[model samples]
Target: MRRRKKKHEDEHMDESWLIPYADLLTLLLALFIVLYAASSVDAQKFKELSQAFNEVFTGGTGIMENPSPGETQPPSDGEVKSSGAEKEEKKEKADLDKEEIERQAFLKDQEELKEIQKKVNEYIKTNNLEVQFVTKLTDEGLLLTIRDNVLFDSGSAVVHSADLNVAKELSELLVMNPPRNIIISGHTDDVPIRNAEFDSNWELSVMRAVNFMKIILENQELNPQWFSAKGFGEFEPVGDNGTAEGRGLNRRVEVLILPRVTD
Candidate 1:
C-alpha cells in the first residue's frame, strides 16, 4: 500500500518543477504589464514617471520633481527662439503702421494749403490794380506781397482812398478762411524821415503797420486774437536802395499766414 501511494504522488506533482513554472508565469505577467504601461505613456507624463522611479531606486531627490506653485514648465529651445522672433515681427509691423498714418496726415495738410493759394491768386487777378502782388509757399506758410505805393502815400503813413476797396476785399477773404496766425510787416527804403508826428523811418513804418491792422480789424467777421503787426523800417530790404527799381521793391508790406497744427 505505501509503495502504491508513493507512485501516485510522484505521478500527480513535482515540488521543484512547480516552483520554477510559477516563477516563469509571474515574470511573464510582470513583463506584459511593463510593456502596456510604456505603450500608454506620453512624453510629458513618461518623463515625470521616470523621475519618480529614479528617485525611489537611487534614494536620491530628483531635480525635476516637487516644483513650486509659481514655477513654469521648462520651455524647449526651439519654442523659446520662436516666441522672441514673433515679438520682434509684431513690433516692426506696429512701427510701420504709425509711420504710414503720419505720412498721410502730412499730405492732407499740403493739399489744403494749395487750395488756399489758388483762391487768393484768383482774387488778385480779378482786380485791375497797378500794384504787383506776389504769393509764395514757405515753411512759415503763405506769404502775400503788396507794393507800398498801392496802399500808402509817398513819405506818409496814411493809406490811400483807392486802396480802401483792396483792404476790404482782402479782409473778407481772411475772414472766410482763417489762418493759424497772421502777421502784417511794414518795410521802408533807406530814405530817412523826420516830422512833428514821427521821429524817423522806424516810427513811420510802425504807424503804417498799425493802420493796416486797423483796417483788417474793422471787419466784424475777422478774429483779432491771432493777428499781429510789426514794422521793420529800413532794416529789412528785399532789394538795394541805390537804384529806382530796387528802392521801389524795398518799399513793400508783407502779409504772412501761419498754418495751424490742430486743424
Candidate 2:
C-alpha cells in the first residue's frame, strides 16, 4: 500500500461558494432592473415591474403589494389630482390679470375721449358754428360733422372762402398732436348729377373731400401723412332722399379724429 500510495490521490477543494456568487449576481441584475424602472415614467412598465417584484418577493401575491422592505408608498391619487388643480388655478389667475389690464386701458381711453369732447364742444360754442358744424365723441372717436352748405355751393367741390377759417381752426387743434389721424369723408344726396367737371356725384363727392383736406394741409403744421380722404356719393346717406330737408341732411362732410390704441 505504501508503495502504491494511490499516487498520493490528487486533492481537490470544495466549490460550494459558487452558489452564493451566482445568487449575488442574480440579485444585482434584479436591482439594476428595479433602478431602471424607478427612473422611468412609463406606467405600463411600472405595472409589469410591480408584478414581477411581487412574484419574486411576496411569493406571487397581489400586484399592488409592496415588494421592498420599509419602503414609503408612492404618491396618492389625491396628490396627483391636487397638482393638476393647482396648474388650472394658475392659468385662470393669469387670464384674469390680463383682462384687468385691458379693462384699465379701456377706462383710460374713455376718460381721454371725454376730455377731448368737452374741448371740442366749447370751441364750437365759442365760434357759434354749431349749426354748420357739430362735434361729438363716439366709439369711433371724436367726430366733426359739417353741413355741405358750409363748405360748398350747389354741386361744386370748391371750399367756400368763408369756411376757410374753419379749416384753419381744425388744423390748429391738430397741430398739438402732429401724428393724430384726420379722416375726411364726403357724402352726397341720392339725386343723380350731370356736370361739366365731374361726371357723377361720386366724383364730386371725392373731389369735395380732397379739396377740404387740401385746405387743412395749408397750415403746414399738421402732418400730411396722417390725413386721409374718402367719399360715399349717394350710398351712405344719413337721411331720407324723399324730402328736401332730409336730402340737405344727407349732403355733408365728416371729419373723424381716430382713436389710438393704448398699450
What is the per-residue lDDT of model 2 for residues 1-263, given as tens digits with 9 covering 90 to 100?
35744565677789999999999998899888878876676655766788878788778787445444324457779998999999999999999999898888777776766777777778888988889888877778778889999989999999989889987887776664426677999999989999788888998899999999998899887778899999989999878999999899889998888777544
| lDDT to native, each model | 0.78, 0.83
> What TM-scores do the predictions have?
0.64, 0.69
lDDT (tens digit, per residue) of candidate 1 on 199-235 = 8888888889889889988999888988899999999
lDDT of 2 at 199: 84
lDDT of 2 at 21: 98
Leading candidate by TM-score: 2
| True-structure RMSD, every candidate | 8.8, 8.4
Which 10-residue window of candidate 1 scores lowest in summed lDDT? Answer: 63-72
Give per-residue lDDT, candidate 1, residue 140. 77
Model 2 residue 18 lDDT? 97
